[model samples]
Target: MLPLFHNLLLQLDSASGILRITLNRPSKLNALNAATIEEIRQAMQYALDAQAVRGILLTGSGDKAFVAGADIAELAELNEIVGRRMAEKGQEVFCLIEESSKPVIAAVNGFALGGGCELAMACHLRVASENARFGQPEANLGLIPGYGGTQRLAQLIGKGKALELLMTTDQVKADEALRLGLVNHVVPAAELLPFCEQLLGKILSKAPLAIGMIIDCVNAAYDQERHGYQTEANLFGRCCGSADFREGTQAFLEKRPAAFTGE
Candidate 1:
């Protein structure tokens, strides 16, 4: 069972083992406020802990946005010390999503600007609606992306282009975002969630442990303290010790579908 949230709507599809977490403040274009962020963190933890949840699909309640940005009203009140803490808090929650063992895909239904774009980038994959617009426009506020956007944006696209977007505050349309390698797929607005579900359905069918280890290895590639190759080797050895690995090999030899228990 999923916990109730003040700012989110959690629906666990038991048949598909996918948790759908919707940011529920449609009146605010699903903007992230401190309450919303904290609730998201809680919801993410629930998804992470639930054995029935194989993956997560994150989106907003309304058609206008997945998350337009952080709540500017709340942002305006931040002092220097509070601003730093606020950034750290947001980053901490976002990193939880980034480093999850279970796959999380952002279904970008519309504008994903500022912190919204950061949240999308933190996801394992992003599927944007044709109407979706992505940008890091914090510079307009005399600020910068505090939720790992500066780093992840550069990593997702390129440092040069990232710098251009950050400086110019240009919003990349869905098609342009795809070309920039920011979003994995650009489908019609109506098909955004369905497409993400279809994509996750395919991934969830794979060996769960291996899927998680792959996430770890890929993330390790960007971790300065971790050797990606060594992480892969270690995880490979770990996978070799699992029942799923044994079943996978045996099923491959027998020409049958393998049933992975995530063991």
Candidate 2:
């Protein structure tokens, strides 16, 4: 089912230089059904057009689940050919999340399993609520994460932990997730929103072009070879010479909070 506010997988609002995208369907524990997937794709399109939006915060509608996983029922009936197509589509959608110019942060509030883990991993960063738990339970169902889970999880948490999670199909507690570097921050359930907002406050104030460049360079580093460090160096130099650089430096010298225009 579509969200009440829009034909989106979730609730989206643009305010304070941030876009808060809530994974709706609380009644279903916010599972990633087909409609939810389409809605997420639509939300990404909306983010592309809306100038006021800067950062994206992805979270579940309630405290019970971020997303249990993809709609397994949908996957059960697929044969070889259709399953391949489904995997391809899922990859495209997740790549769109990773490659978006704006910064994307996943606020994992509850159960982030399988595709849920992939979704969070696709984002630039993740923060979780105290109640959040994470896993890749695909092995239990005689499957694997179809949405870049194996690749991204290894990249974020190192190969050992990724393999462990995949092999054991066990869920880790929120603190364990933090220690493993799967999530940037973990806070009390009550403080989840405030913590996410605080993190975005810092990111939203940074130079927009620089942030975009950062994403480009990081993705390049992975998309190909270690040669991307050269590109990173070049972009760093460019940022140092940009207008935001000047404004930030001058503000520092003036001893007041920098009034960054994101120029």
Candidate 3:
């Protein structure tokens, strides 16, 4: 069952274990206001706690934008202290999405700028529509990416390219984003969510625990202090002790499909 969220729509496909979240403020081009961000955080937490949720497909309502950017009016009211707090809050929320146990895929159907771009970067995978546009246009507003965009964009693409995009406020098309490794797939606008669901469905069929461990290890690779190899080794050892590992190996020998309980 889908729970009601003030600024978002949540729908869970129990059979597929895929949760679809739509950013609902289409009139504003689905801009990320504080309320919307908080609602998203709560919704993500709800997804995490729901046992039936195996994967998430995040997108926005309407055809125009995934999220154009942050709500400019709200942004205009920030003082230095308030601005710092807002940035920290946004970082924390996006961090949760990045660190989610279940894979979260961004189905970027249209304009994804500033926070919108950062939001997509936070997802484990991103699928964009052929007409999708991505940019960190905060430079034009006399600001910069405040929600982990500076770091995540560079991580997804390259530091040099990320800097150029940030400074120039240049928008990249879906094809260029794919070429730069910013998005995984580029599909027709109508197929965006379906493509993400199809890809996530395949991933959700695997051992859920192992999938979570993979996310953790991959994230560790980006942390300068944490040795990714060590994290992988540790997670590997843990997996060795899981029932899913035993079942997986046994099923391979038996030539049957393995059933993982996420234990």
Query: What is the C-alpha lDDT profile of model 2 across 40-80, one tens digit per residue?
Result: 88787677667777778888887889988877788788888
TM-score of each: 0.99, 0.90, 0.98
lDDT of 3: 0.94
Q: Rate the local accuracy (lDDT) of all candidates.
A: 0.94, 0.83, 0.94
> Which TM-score value belongs to model 3?
0.98
Clashing pairs in 1: none
Clashing pairs in 2: 9-39
Which lDDT value does model 3 have at 262? 86
Give the range of the ten consecutive residues with the poorest summed lDDT in model 2: 1-10
- lDDT agreement of model 1 with the native: 0.94
Query: What are the root-mean-square deviations of the candidates from the true structure over C-alphas?
Result: 0.7, 2.7, 0.8
lDDT by residue (tens digit), candidate 3, 80-169: 999999999999999999999999999998999999999999999999999899999998989999999999999999999999999999
